[model samples]
Target chain A: MLSKKVILYFILITGGIITLAPFVWMLSASFMYDGHANVYPPRFIPDIFTLTQYEVLFQRLDIGKNFINSLFLSITVTAVSLFFNSMAGFAFAKYRFKGKNKLFNLLLSSMIIPAQVTMLPLFLMLKSVGLINTYMAVIIPGMANIFGIFLIRQYVLSIPDSLIESAKIDGASDFRIYRSIILPLAMPILVTLAIFTFMGTWNDFLWPLIALTDNSMYTMPVALANLMGEHSKDPELMMAGSVVTIIPVIIVFLALQKYYIKGIMMGSVKG
Target chain B: MRIRYSAPYLFLTPALTAIFVFFFIPVIAAFVISFTDFDIYAINNFGTARFIGFDNYKALINDQLFWTSLKNTFYFVIAAGPLSIAISLGAAILLSSKLVRLKPLFRLTYFLPVVTTLVAVAIVWRFIYHPRFGILNYFLEFFGINPIDWLGDPNWAMPAIILMAVWKNFGYNMIIFIAGLQNIPEDLYEAATIDGANGWQKFKKITLPMLAPTTLFISIITMIGFFQLFAEPYVMTQGGPLNSTLSIVQYMYQEGFRWWNMGYSAAIAFVLFLIIFTGTLIQFKLQKSPEA
Candidate 1:
């Protein structure tokens, strides 16, 4: 019985190591010189560390520009999407209107339609509008989404309808009720949605890859993918690029993890 | 009397417009494009465009690459879908047990990968699966096992992708399962125990029956997510090892953007939609039936 307990402990420790080792190696490899990472005896610790890979990335590859681009795009998309989704969600939750439930249901049911189904046509439409290589191409599609609306609607519905009714009796304008009342009460869900939108925009690869043909307009993930295409052999440089792309997202997720996790549970179970 | 109601639609206008333009319109346009020959040349000059009817989809039926992608997608979904659910269910049960201390710590640790950026994780796994110098091979060596070519071998590539996906995704379903488990009445388990049921018997007879709705929900969502396998192959394998890990979305991206076969790509996208939609319908039916 004691031996079995020890064995279980061993398994858990190993499992934890297995789960985390890749990230450890990624950090280690990022600090190594170019050819040092692929050595036969796989060094877990860098013998000699240098910031040259990062220098190469910023100076030669101009990944800093892509970093700024990704940052700008993600922040813009998150802010805009939060504002748009909240307004609609608040309306659905508090207001009585013809076809409101039906419209909401339509949106909810169509969530199963994978985003890829629309990518081709979306690209063409954006191209026709001459917005293909612009950030608008990415931001417009992400401006509002069914999931975001559904999430906010679910949370907002839990707010007593009487609150909105009282506000209306107090002669608050519709927009005023939304801006002042709904926004504050919905702050938690808003932050949660903000995290989701931010992470999603930060990690988005395919649409950006498709939409932004210009190197000048590339997001971090898109740029990293492109960098990998050209610099497949440069493990250290690629690791630095991957680190730059990932760290912001990780920090954001960790910072708002409580709301993020709650959002996931609410979204998944309710969904 | 309901002039007050105009405000809701007014407030809804921006979001509805965005969704209609960006989402619904594009979906309808994709269907239309799938029926036409909208290539790069046609993009340059719409006058040159030809309406190809179902030829693009018919061509897909004959195209070997399309079939390969379809098979690869199915391979991923079939291999990973059940494996993820099982692992999640098991972990949920273990974590929910009174025997487990520090449940939040364990849950957070397990759930960490689910929230991390996929591209970053995929990059890490690429290094971890490095043929010569990976930690995976080092550990396998300790067991006197041969180093497996995780991403490079054609046979192992999809399986490798599936394994990584299961690891990344199981935590999500685990949370749902834990919630489901918590909602199950304690008296049911107590009643089963008093009736002389063993742990396994109690689980099979009581817990499984009670968790049916949650399980159905998880399965359908998992199926939908697994069907859209893109970034894992894109980042880890680039749909390589002779395209063994090429997923439907990856193929669509390549066909549409890489080769400039927009119409043909739309056809592939519709096919993916068809598969996912049918899978969802079947899951709903199964849930409605007496199998529970």
Candidate 2:
């Protein structure tokens, strides 16, 4: 029995190390000076730990601009999406209307249509309206997603209708009921959705790669990729850039992981 | 009464309108544009583009690169999908075991890659797969295996990407599987143990059957997501080493954005949609009939 327990720990620990090694390597290599990461029998730690790689990334590469771009876009998308999805979700949950079921079902089924199908025409449409190469190009499509609305609606459904009815009887307006009752009750799911949205926008590569044509407007991922194109020889610098790109989302995930994990479980409950 | 009647629509108006204009319309427009010879010229003036039905699809059929990308995408989905799901299930089972301690810490460590920026990690793995200085090759040398040019060899490029993808994604499905495992009533396991069933028998008789629905859901979503492989190969090899790792979405991006062959790109997009839709339907059908 003792041997079995030892074997289990051994397996778990081994798996954990394999899973974390790349990240550990990345963090270690980021602090090495130029050409230092390329030596044979790769050094796991810097010979003389330095901040030169990070200094180059921020000062020479001006990745700070891209960092701001990513942060701005992620926060903007998350806040706007939360508002729009919650409003739509509240309507779907509490209200009676013509074709509500039909419309909701249509929206649900449309989720299967991959976003790639719309990218070409969406680009064209945005280009025609002269919205290309702007923040709006990213924010517009992300303003409200079907999944966000569905998640919000599922959580909002559990809020007792009696509260809304009581609020209504007290001559509170419809908007008032939504603002006071639904919003407060749905806070947990909202936080969950917020984390998902924030991470998604921060980590997004494709759309930003397409829409943000200028280098200055590039998000962290796109900037990192662009830097990679020109600086593949500089592993230390690239690793530093990578570290900068990933740290915020990791911190966000670790800080709010309970909500994030709950969100995933809630989303998988077959809606 | 008037205000009450209008309230839902008022609340829904912003979201519904955004979806209608940005999402629904673009989807329809993409379908329409796929039937036309839309290109850079079409971007300048819509009237210059000519309607050419099925030509794009025919072109795709004849296009060697498109076929290569389709094959590569299927290869990725078929290979990586099952491998990731299996690892996820194994990890889920281990974590859920009563003997485990520090379950949350272990889970967070494993799930770290899932939440990181994909482009950044792909770059990190690109270096990690380095032939001479890479930690992977350095570790493998202890087992008497020679260093491998992981991203430089046609035979190994796809496998490298698959390994990285599996590492990055398994934690997601692991979380879902843990939820599924927890949902199984404790009494089911209690009854099996009381019957003098061994561990393997209990798992086969109780766990597998109970986890069917969750497995089905995981498999379908994982397949869909895997079929859309782009960033790893894009950042790692640019679909190189003889294009062994080019994905369908990458191909679409090349034609649509890089080359501005919008019509052909839209056609490829539709094919992807059809494949995913068919895959989902087939899974649903398969899952339904087995129980009956």
Off by over 4 Å in 1: A1-11, B1-3
TM-score of each: 0.96, 0.99
Off by over 4 Å in 2: B1-3
Question: Per-residue lDDT tens digits of candidate 1, residues A1-271?
Answer: 6665565556555656766677777788889888988887788888899888889989998899999998999999999999899989988887788888899999998888899999987887888889999989989999999899989999998998788778888888989989988899999999999998998899887889889999999998888877777877777888888788888887887788889888877876774
TM-score quality measure for candidate 1 = 0.96
Write one digit per residue (lDDT tens) for candidate 1, span B1-292: 2248588888899999999989999999889889888898988786676888889999999999899999999999998999999989988887787655677767777787877668767777777787787778888898998999999999888878888898888989999899889999999999988999998999999889899989988999899989999989998898999989999999998999889899999999999999999998888898889865
DockQ of candidate 1 (2 decimals): 0.65
**Model 2 clash pairs?**
none
- Model 2 C-alpha lDDT per residue in residues B14-80, reported as the tens digit of each score: 9999999989999999999999999998889999889998999999999999999999999999999
